[model samples]
Target: MVVKRRFRQVFTSLKEHSRVSYAKIATIGGFCDLDLIVVKATSPDDLPLPDRYVHELLKIFSVSASSFRAFSLSFTRRFGKTHCWRVALKCLVLLHRLLRSLPDDSPFRSEILWTRSNGLLSLYPCHFLDDSSSASEDYTMFIRSYARLLDEVLDCLSIESKEAEEDEVLESLPDKMKEVGRMLEVLPQLQSIIDRVMDCRPTGASTRSFLVQSATKHIIRDSFICYTTFRKEIVMILDNLFQIPYRSSIAAFGIYKKAALQANQLSEFYDWCKFAGLCGSYEYPFIDRIPQIQVYALENFLNGMWQLTESSSSPASLLTSTMESPLSSTEDDSDKQLVIWEKVEENAFPRKLVKDEEEEPLLQWDVVDNGNWEDLLEASIGPCKASRNNLFYHSNGYGNNMGEYGQGEEANGWQMQLYNPYASNPFYQPQT
Candidate 1:
């Protein structure tokens, strides 16, 4: 039996190698490097991938948008053809690492978001199963669950990217309400994925290979990070409700209930993680639950919001108008004029001129024009020399500095200062 299994493994490996070679030969002109990198990175084995190949793929993916496209195509094609669970898991791992390593604003990440939003990214073809043995069956189940979790991860990342973009314009009440609704939608999806993540544990001793153990550890870590983010988002949603004066009390109560329940579930999940030994050493902060008093306050707030909504034609604008600057009102014309005068006074002198005035007392020097300047210039062929004691020099040209006419010590004293209009005003005092 052992001999037959070894022979089958060797034959499978040889076949996979042939297929890879053929692929490389086929794509020799374009994306051969990418194909080679993916093949080596996801080598058909039950061992952890080497860091070197991952680094190489990252280097290629980071090259340009074209390289990102080529790598995605090559990796997808390679994974699609693969029939072994080891290679499929490795491909998922590579993708996870790449997504995690890519910056939030990376062009490639934006590309991923666009593709995912358009339903263009097709990663499901990478699924594979080798269920001839009990151990293989266990791995197959874990891989399916892992694939689902990864899909959720990608979706989560895309949602986060979109949320980041939306946050810039999320100041309005309607936008904030929409954002809260979107976040509420994301929580249920994330909780479902978390359930899947928790289910991907080892069933028996037969499935506890080094590779499985490593993958399980990563899944646990990623799940924990996701849960942490989930908890924070829920808390944020609950807190942001108070900032908006006019909101639906029924919806707010529903959100609070969902958050409180999820909080308990997340706490239990954390306990499970600790028991599983993957996260035993790490300590997660205890998230505070929503208080009953806060819920009552939210109810009253929302009830008031309903009244305001019925009474006001534009409740959101009316609420925000309360926070506007008093000077912005048309009734405060005198205050506005005073503010304008203060601003004009502040701009009376530029910062550089103000600093120069502060550093030195203003002194007036008489401009002594020599009638022998033309005769002296006509006599001298080269640059003229001027005395260093003079603080100013007159240049014949508009833009030409004093240095062009004379390269002497007088050029060193050629301080070009701007005229400060406020300097002549006796009433003007330098701003404190």
Candidate 2:
């Protein structure tokens, strides 16, 4: 009888403070679900339950104060107290239904169940997560800095407009024009900062490993999602700014292209990491397939750009040779060999020689003596001797026959005399 009275009092208090109907409270299947909703509600002023109602509810539900307090502190610290309790209750109920859909022995099932029962805010604690708050802060800083730069650029444009009005007849502009020019000069510096921010993504192997080591897979995945969304918002802002006619110069296009490229690479890496996280394996076919997929994407982008431009020159052509080689050489070895052969065919014989059937034979072999074959062979096989006009023999003591022959004026003259095949005498000397 006493227990029934205490439950009645707790229900009445909950009805008064939370505005929940008595019929609904009575129809709740278990004390645990009621307790979860009440705890989540009590953390914020969104549903302001009186202190006495909270105490009675906890006592009736048999929930420990310490557990509720810990969960409230942790959750409020991370997400703040601005959430709507009714919406939070709905989300929790939906999440609980989803969890119940999983198999009984699933790790996620056990982990989420344990977190709920222990009054923990998340399946994985905030302490186990990476410092994503710092990254968010940095992102905010980048946005502010870029916003200021844009403002300055706008100011410069305004000043230039004013100077143009005042300098209609002047050959050169005055100090205001000079000031605007100086302000415009700082635009590149601003663009460089934007480039740095885009390139600052945490896609390195070590950073990913660190995140995996320190946090749950879901935490790391959520962090990546947050980061990617943040960057996407910034990219949208940049795209909007670039749409302004004055800012649509070639240099601005180049900066936007670079930022888009880096963002794409980061997003690809994040997607791969997320897939690896879900599959619980970062090894093997997963890692190996990333480059292939990237190359495929690059090929599509290049092809699309080529179709749009229809020009021989492409923006991608400006990439360093090393980057272009891998992208261009994605074909199989047989295909590559075929390409090489085609090139060889095109370049090897650019001009064809005309046939001359009426032309005489270049040499008459019948006049050659067949008996002198041995002598011809001996002469052809022997080392050549250097002549007097050869600079190499004059510089080096060794003749063209190498060390086998000495370098002397008399020996050279004698060799030259012996070389006169048309002379009647065996030895002949010509005037120096």
Q: Please write out the lDDT profile of model 2 over residues 263-299, one tens digit for every residue.
A: 5555565565556453244421221122333322333
Clashing pairs in 2: none
Runs in model 1 deviating more than 4 A are 1-13, 17-32, 113-127, 131-134, 164-193, 202-207, 242-252, 283-432
34: Cα error in model 1, Å: 0.8
lDDT of 1 by residue, 1-20 (tens): 77776665666677676765
Query: Residue pairs in steric clash, candidate 1?
Result: none
- By summed lDDT, the worst window of 10 consecutive residues in model 1 runs over 335-344
Query: What TM-score fits each model?
Result: 0.55, 0.19
Best by lDDT: 1
Local distance difference test, each candidate = 0.54, 0.32
